[model samples]
Target: MKNLSLQWRITLMTALLIGATCIFMNVLIGYSGRHYMDSIGSHITGYEETGGEDPDFFDPRRERLDQELTIVIHGAQESFIATNWYITAAAALLGGVLAYFLSGHALKPLRTFAAQVEKVQPNNLTDTKIPEAVLPEFRQFSRSFNQMLDRLDSGFAAQRQFTGNAAHELRTPLSLMQAQLELFSAEHPEVSPETADFLRLLREQTERMTQMTKTLLEMSELRTVPCTERIEIGPMVEEIFTDLAPLAERKNITLKATGDGTMTGSDTLLYRLLYNLTENAIRYNRPDGTVHIAVAYEASCLHITVTDTGCGIPQPYRESIFQPFFRVDKSRSRENGGVGLGLSLAWEIVALHGGEIRVAESSEKGTTIAVSFPTDASAD
Candidate 1:
């Protein structure tokens, strides 16, 4: 009973109720019939001696009348018990069917609310909310859920604005510091080896900070960016591969692009999306490793896969790889000049285009990332 679904529970309870009512009615009828029969017998016995008949006389006709009356009442009792059993069974069956459907009908609003909730995403947070329901309880639930969504929308907006502002503010100071450090290093050509090493380290840190700030700004603005241009997948892949070929060549890694697909999106953002993925593939790969890019259309959706023969991501880290500032191998990431934001930025770009990005496969051998986007020209 505890494990039963709502509909089943409702049906069972309804059937039990109907059966109980029928049993109670049957018991009342039987009791009343027996009492009436006893009263009539008493009256019949009293009347038998009313017409100057012997009080103790065994009258054959009177005996026959009494016997017939007893038979008739006993037969009626038996008929009623049998008939009531059939009626109770039929009522229980009917009640179960009605309860099953009635429960489903009553829960339809909750099902609709769940479906709407599933479609809500950060990019479209403001536009999605639970619609009003007719039932009072469901209506209240919808109202509360909409209020929660409003708070979430406000919080996300504030976070994005703050990130953008902070990133913008940090960039100017970083640029000025980099220029000042370069001027000081050039002016002090006779500095000790230790001072030169310190200055070089300072310059490197400043550059890293500048890159991080730029990535942060890009991530912050992704929510407000709109994708309106139609891009051919084949050409875009070719161009991205060409642009990143130098980086791949430095490690003797091979870059290959194949298949044809197209989607509607911002070209700049899409470029960044592919660039980050390809760049990571190149940066993390072993010498002479291969990076493969493929795009294809399936069921009105475009599928893009990037596979790299690099040191694969661990299973535990794969889930958090797209999170900002999360790195699987911190030391390796630093050596590769990674600030742990490439995949995070890629994820944001994919979300902005209303697509999905996921690590399709990973192991000690290598890793593969698959992205899917609606092929519809109007998808955003």
Candidate 2:
């Protein structure tokens, strides 16, 4: 019943109700007619007349009356059944037609509200609102929906503004601190081993903070990035690998790229997306491990997958790994100076482009991360 459309459901219910009513009326009429015939037969045969005829006497008049009554009763019953069937069928047909149109009309407001809701997106969050419905129930629903959208639009705006401002303000101080440290280290070349180690640690932590701030700013700004460029994913992947090849070389990891496709989105965001995934693959991989990147057009979408022979992500941690500051291996992540924002940022970038990303496969042997974007050749 849930799988059926509203119009058909209404039609079926109406037909059943009319059909039952017709059956009840026919039964009542048939019962009344039988009772009336029985009374008439009793009178015609003189059963109520005491001592009017001998018992078992065959009177032609009375016999003819009995036969006529039986015939009349059977004929009336047959006629009533045939007539009721035609009336019932006509009533069912009429009820179904009326119910179909009535149901569609009754649901018009809901359909209108759905259409309005579909036009609301992050960029147009404040521009769209469901109109007041004529029906009281639908009007209440519209009001609630509009209120929710208002809260979301306002909250998102505040968060984005705060992130962008904080990141921008922190960068100058962070950069200055880094410069001062470099100068201090250079000036005090004869410092003790303990002092040198402390300075190195300080510098490393400073660099990590700077990178984190930069990533936050990028993620905040991504929501407003317009999708107007046709990015050839093949060349973008190639360029990212070229820049990170030296890093991969340190661990003897192999970087490979295969397949190509095109999508319409911000080139900068797309680069950041691929860069983050590829970098993580190389960073966490085993010595002599291989990182393979593949791109292809599948099911009307452009798919990009990064597979690495790294210690696979544990099943329990896979879902949370894409959350900001969430690390599967906290000790290893800290040792590698990772703040755990890479995957989170990458996920946001994909979402901004109306795409999807997921951990396609993971095991002790390797892990695969796949991203897909709707294919659009016109943008190319």
Candidate 3:
């Protein structure tokens, strides 16, 4: 009963009520019939009575009448009970069927409301209100739901505007500071050791801030990417390798790509996703270790695997690695000058293209990250 759906619950309760009523009426009618039979029988004839003229004579006619009355009353009671039981059973069954259908009809609006809520995504938030012409019972609920959606839309819009403005405002000052510091370092190569150290630390921190702001600005404005062109994974891999060749060389890690795949999405965003994955693979990897990239098409999906001989992520941090500013080893990440937004941006990019990214496997030997882009079902 606890696990039953609302519809079934209602139906069962209604049927039980109807069955109880029928049984109660049946018992009442049966008792009334028995009482009436007893009253009529007692008046109609006596069960045993001796004759008045003769001392030992019996009245067989009255005895026979009494016997007939008993038989008729018992037969009528038995017939009435059996017939009423059948009628009670039928009424319960019919009541359950009617209740089930009626309950389904009553709950149809809730199902519709749930489906509409499911379809409300960030990009498609406008005009998400349920129509005013809906049933009176749902009108208030729908109005409240639409108002909540309006608040969410406004919040999102305000957040994007603030992030974009802040990033833009901060970028110029950071760039100016970086240029001034570099120029100063070049002009005075004879600075004191303490001053040099302070300047270097300041430069690193400034660079970190600049990178974070740039990434944030990109994220804030990533809503309307022109994803018209089909991007080939092979060429994109080549480009990322060329850009990060110096970083790989510095770490003495070998980079390799195997197989070819293609997907249709924003080329710029997709490039960043791969770049971030590959860059992280190289950044955290051991000296002379290997970073391998593999792309393939399987089951109407494009899968890209990046495996690196780096310190593997712990089991608990696997999911949190995609979150902004989350790091498994904060100290090591800082040594690599990571702001922790590389993987976060990668995640957002993959999600924008309706893809998935996850840590496929990790161990002492190496870690493998898998990215998949789903294609149209018709292509399958």
Candidate 4:
């Protein structure tokens, strides 16, 4: 009972009520019927015992008539009880069936409402609402849900605005600091060793901050980017490979790509998704390790897979790796000049295109990240 759905619960409760009523009615009717038959039989039999019938009938005849009356009354009572039991059982079962179907029909609107809610997303929340013309029972609920969505949409919009503003504001100070440090270093190349080292650290930190801000701004803007462009995979993969060739060479990692597919999405965002995956593969890989990317369109979904023979991510961290500032090995990520936002931005890009990304498989040997963009995202 605790685990049953609302519809089933309603059906069962109704069935139980109907069954109880039927049982009570059957019992009452059976008792009255048995009593009436016995009273009538006794009344007719009593006349004979009082000597109301002919004496020629004799005492043996009287006994026989009374015996027949007793037999008939008891038999009718037993048959009446049996019939009531059968009818009660039938009524209970029939009530349960009708209740089950009726409950399902009554709950259909709720199911449809749930499905529509499931389709709502952050980017598509503006103007998202359930119709007010729904069933009376759901009308108030629908209006309240829409109002909640409105509040949520407004909140998200404000957050995005804040992010964009904050990122832009930080970029200026970071650029200024970087530029001043460089100019000062150029002017005084003969500074003390300690001072020079300190300046270099400042420059590095400032540049890292700048890049972080840029990534943040891009993430916030992703929602506004249109995903209607038809982007091809082969050429884009080649471009990413070309851009990262120097880094791959420095790390002694091999790069490979195969298969081509086209998907409808923001060209820039799709490129970032590919580039981030490929870059991470190369940056974290073992010396002489290999990175392979494959693209395919199958079963109406565009799939992209990036496999790398790297220091494999642990099982638990696979899901966490996409979070902003999340790193499997903080020191190693820093050494790779990563501030831990590449994969985060990749995740944002995928979401903007209404796609899915996940670590397909991972172990001590290697890891494969799979991405899929199913169907057209422009429906939003």
Better of 1 and 2 by lDDT: 1
lDDT, each prediction = 0.86, 0.85, 0.87, 0.89
Give residue 49's lDDT in candidate 3 (0 to 100).
41
Best candidate according to lDDT: 4
Question: What's model 1's TM-score?
Answer: 0.83
After TM-score superposition, the amount by which residue 361's alpha carbon in candidate 2 deviates from its true location, in angstroms, is: 2.0
Task: Give TM-scores for every candidate, taking all chains together and pairing residue i with residue i.
Answer: 0.83, 0.80, 0.76, 0.86
| lDDT of each residue in 280-371, candidate 1, tens digit only | 99998889999999988777788999999998988888889999999988998888888999999999888878788999998767889999
Question: How far in Å is the alpha carbon of 158 misplaced in model 2?
Answer: 0.7
Scored by lDDT, model 2 comes in at 0.85
Model 3: per-residue Cα lDDT over 31-120, one tens digit each: 887788778766665324433455356668765877887899789878877888898889889988999999899988888898989767
Candidates 3 and 4: which is better by TM-score?
A: 4
Worst 10 residues of 4 by lDDT: 371-380
Winner by TM-score between candidate 3 and candidate 1: 1
Counting clashing residue pairs in each candidate, in order, gives 0, 0, 0, 0
Highest TM-score against the true fold, candidate: 4
Candidate 2's error at 127, in angstroms?
A: 6.9
Query: Could you tell me the TM-score of candidate 4?
Result: 0.86
Output the better candidate (1/4) by TM-score.
4
Off by over 4 Å in 2: 1-26, 33-65, 68-72, 78-136, 375-380
